[model samples]
Target chain A: MDIKNILISVDASDNAMRAVDYAASILANAEGVRVTLLYIERAPNRDKFDDEAAWLNQCKLDHDRVFDFLKTARQKLVAAGLPEASVHERTVLCSAEPSIAQTILDVQQAEGFGTLVVGRRGLTKGEEFLFGSVSSKLVHNAKNCAVWVVQ
Target chain B: MPESVRELVERFKPPVSVRTYGTVFTDTTEFMNIGYGDVIKLGGRYYLVLGDERERRFGMEDPKFWVKRCVEMESGQYRILKLEFQESFDQHIGSLTITCHRSAAKEARILRLVAGDMRFMQGLGVRDERGNLARVLERVAGRRLDLNIEDLHQSHREYFQETFPGILQRFIGACRAIHHLHQHGETHGDIRRDHLYVDHKTGEYCWIDFDYGYDSVENPFGLDLFGLGNILSFITGKGVHTIQDVDAEALGITEADCALFFRHRVVNLRKLFPYIPADLNNVLMHYSAQSEVFYESVPELLADLEPCLENLRRA
Candidate 1:
């Protein structure tokens, strides 16, 4: 049923790998289950600073690192028993959206992905209070899409 | 909680039990005599209560009777010390009856919930050792919307054409901020023109007093939406257009064509000014005496406001 393609977001973090592991465990034998590893190369918010060159350099390094994580996630999914031909990698170079969760959903909607998977990063209430909890934002705002959150 | 005047007075019992570090002024003859240079210990920290802030341009500022302007003894930064003031009110619009409250404890809980939200007044819900809950908010540098409007010395038609559209856009921003608070399962219990502050530095319409709220099981945000409606009407009419000020000779309509509150405040704007678009006027009329259908929520109010904003922008 329209749940053929599942998009799993990877960020080179241990929690993101857990999401990859969960996806791998589910698609061991499910035929025609296409898995896409999504890496969002988010632009860092530079609020007070005006240094253009340093910011661009940092963004490039961050993009390359996330792109490497995308390949690693794809390999993990294939090695865990999914078909090598079915798993694909996608990297989106995105500006800072209102929230990262919104960017993930926007890409999912545009590419016709049926299912969305995200990893709930381990952040304390104090940290989440300062910076928002992305996985929580996704869980609340995701509509017309089945979301599998790996805590 | 207060059903009588005595109970209401008891609710706002002044903090006269503070064991001052030094006897600065012992003139305790005046009624409720606590004034400038007074030191009170809260949460083991001392604060020096300041006099009513004055402005050379506008004379003495609006004295916040509920809260006092104080300076933290250690930091020297100004802060708003929220005092124990509990109040509630009831208002009716047509068939809808709304009850609102001024709850200090409820505001403390809400401040904790919306601690990280920038749209709200930044503060900490502090308590003393013996368990007296209070709040110490940052002394924000901003202009209250009420005073901001009072400073605008333009005619109603001139303001409506030139500056009102931009202000309406900002008002929409405030409405969205209210929606954010509602999303977190909290209501800005009191929505007043003075409660909405425009930060001088950020230009963001930050909502200040959240200590006021309602517990309408039928419509939780009904009073809030009505409060927002009143603000909208106030801004549109340049000020509160009492029924006495409006006339058939000046505006081409009488009391029969207009909707007035129980206190005889004019609600209907089409009778006063026919130039107001029907789409926008309809939303304003939703809180009138003749209003059969009412705005149930903030989002419902926003749905009508957004299009009206777009239409105004286009025109």
Candidate 2:
């Protein structure tokens, strides 16, 4: 009931961003709610990159974009009245070959978040179909938390 | 034209196939066969009455009663009157009468009754085609398990003890869900054990059976709050006494004064479930008390639950 810790998975799409906006609005009124912004990047192929160095550089760039987006989102939350201290951000290199849904579920369980908020649509068409336009799969699969899909 | 004929007409058995989808009659649409009889499909969707002497006798009058009873049972919708037999009845040996209550047919057509509504009749184990009562299918799966708080303590003790934290967390979440629903102007009127389905696979609990649920914001929280508290009490072996006994004890009042102390005397989760961790207990107590104070809304209680959950996780 007390949604102190919120886990929102964003993919930088307009819809995903809108979902983040909705989540911020819902939690903004609370006195001390902590929001964790998670962005997952599909890991580039080790074979595609000539060597580990190339892969590392590409990963760094991907992390930068994720961080930059989080930075922008963090500002939005603060602008919406959330304390800067209460907001946390993270980006992970999710190996493209593995299922993203499985990864999200693992992260959610590990994090022990009270609520999981996701956009109805994500970045890729495949992602949209697999996770649904609004992450309906998460709602059906996730345990112990309420899944909110913002239109 | 004798006394027996008059008597037979006056006391004719209630139309046995009254509510049934199809009835058989003569070319003139006069009654041919009736009550608790098997409906034999004559062709594609058409059916005929096929039962022995008892069913034939029942068919004589039961259909009329069935239509009348259904009208009386569900008053709001339209009524179904016995429809006159059509030319189709001429082909059959015994004329097949197609009787229908107009209002009842309209109600069924408009309302789109779910199987659950007819489950009671199904439970009675009456199946003679025309699709048995909804209850029959449900009962066929097996009668529902009646779970009391004692069962939670005994059979599910390990599951409860191991997953107490999650249970408390979900309970708080349920409170929040109810709170949200209230804000949207809805109240889940019945919060009994039967209405709540706990998925053993995921430890998630969902509220179902909304037949009597109300879509009003006013006092929705109390509808489930008291029931939830009592369930918790029952689970912890607090005894199956009336709400007065448990509520009075929790509130520290005598039975005679329970009416006055009713809402105020509700027990906190920590007090009721002593084995809960101190921090978690604090959170439970905070929301439990808040539920009493804001028995009308869930927002405040949810706000309290949020922080307590975080603090418990940290501890």
Candidate 3:
């Protein structure tokens, strides 16, 4: 198989955009390399929050955050010399994955992306263990794909 | 035809066969009992068995009498010498009969594979003079997690809320470690309370002892998952809650609205401790005797545990 696709995990944080820019910069002039902007809409479920309203608000926040980053992530990819035809965006449901990192890996594998690009959230090891960071999990578990964790 | 009379008649009967000649009988086995100062020669090195204070009082009559603490005569470094011990048993879960047996070879295989990996018991498998493969393990100086938390003063509710989350974190880490081991194509096989130790040096729960195996065609690691479930049940309730002991504990708990596990025990912990999060209890229910479906893999178990753990952490 001629593996030529790069999957970038899109997040609302500035660091996630850093990952986008990193992938964009690397594959800017590289031929036959396609880019995918993947965003997992992560939010607390109704049962997780004290009230349904709180859960709805979180859902809205996650929805808006994905859109907020998707726009910039796409423009930056195109601005970095990747064609509009070659760029793809995927917004996956949070419930689809056990963890966000696992979801990204599952999507990457399902889509046959050879390289998975993610951003380092620069969280302390303890914090990462408790809260979990996608970049670290990807670095540890992303098999059959190359993971680039950009700081 | 009474069983007592039949047994009495059999006791008076002589041996079925007697040695007719001086020729040595080749059909018998004489197990050499190893003890303190006993030297076992494995590979090219000799190991002198040693003992701590515990051995002095309790002796080596423990089930794992074959395992001994030793020091390499050449290196002077401490190591655990695991001699082959034939241990096997069967567990009845519904219509299923899970056959568990000891596998020194599997332990040695995993030890060598995960050497220098802190999550697993580290060791090397060496062929002994008897041609049986033995394990020479790097001694991990740590208190077993179960024993460390055995005498806690906190009430079940307090312990469950205050300290369990921390212990659960370590347990989760250990499970993840087991998951990683599974990824490397091996199951811990024996996930027991004593097997998990809180390394005093690193403050991490390190798994030890992997010589156990079972036959489950559907899931090779299913027994391992069951072992993990048993450990979870033990830790969550602060002790094994079998059918026989619930009365002794005097918790005034009833079997109504409860689920029993192996040996008709564990009367639905959610009922006993109502404060236990439903989600967490639901995970435990997978191991209940009444569970229609069971956890097939460690990753599947982890997927269920993550959310409950996150909720607990936040709470």
Give the candidate number with the greatest TM-score: 1
lDDT of model 2 at position B44:
21
Specify the highest-lDDT model's number.
3
DockQ of 2: 0.01
User: Which ranges in model 1 have alpha carbons more than 4 Å from their true place?
Assistant: A1-151, B1-34, B51-66, B85-101, B249-263
lDDT by residue (A65-127, candidate 2, tens digit) is 767778888988888899989888877665422345556777788888778888764323222
| Residue lDDT tens for model 1, B1-315 | 113322322333235653223222222222134456454456655566664443223354655554657666656677877765555577455434545556667678777877877778888877655344568788667988867887898977787778888889989989988888777766786787878888898777888877765542223455577679878887877777776776656765444434434335676776766677788888887766556556656788889989988887787
Stretch of 10 with least lDDT, candidate 2 chain B: B86-95
Error in Å for residue B100 of model 2: 32
lDDT of 3 by residue, B1-315 (tens): 334323332332224442211211111112245555445667766555553213221234334466767667566677887776556677554344546677776787788788888987688987665556677888787888888788898999999989999889889999888887777656776677878889998889899878766532223455567778878887888876665655624665543323333444673677668788999988888766456556757889999998888999998
Candidate 3: TM-score, chain B only: 0.77
DockQ of predictions, in order shown: 0.01, 0.01, 0.01
TM-score of 2: 0.31
Models 1 onward score TM values of 0.56, 0.31, 0.55
- State the fraction of real interface contacts model 1 keeps: 0.00
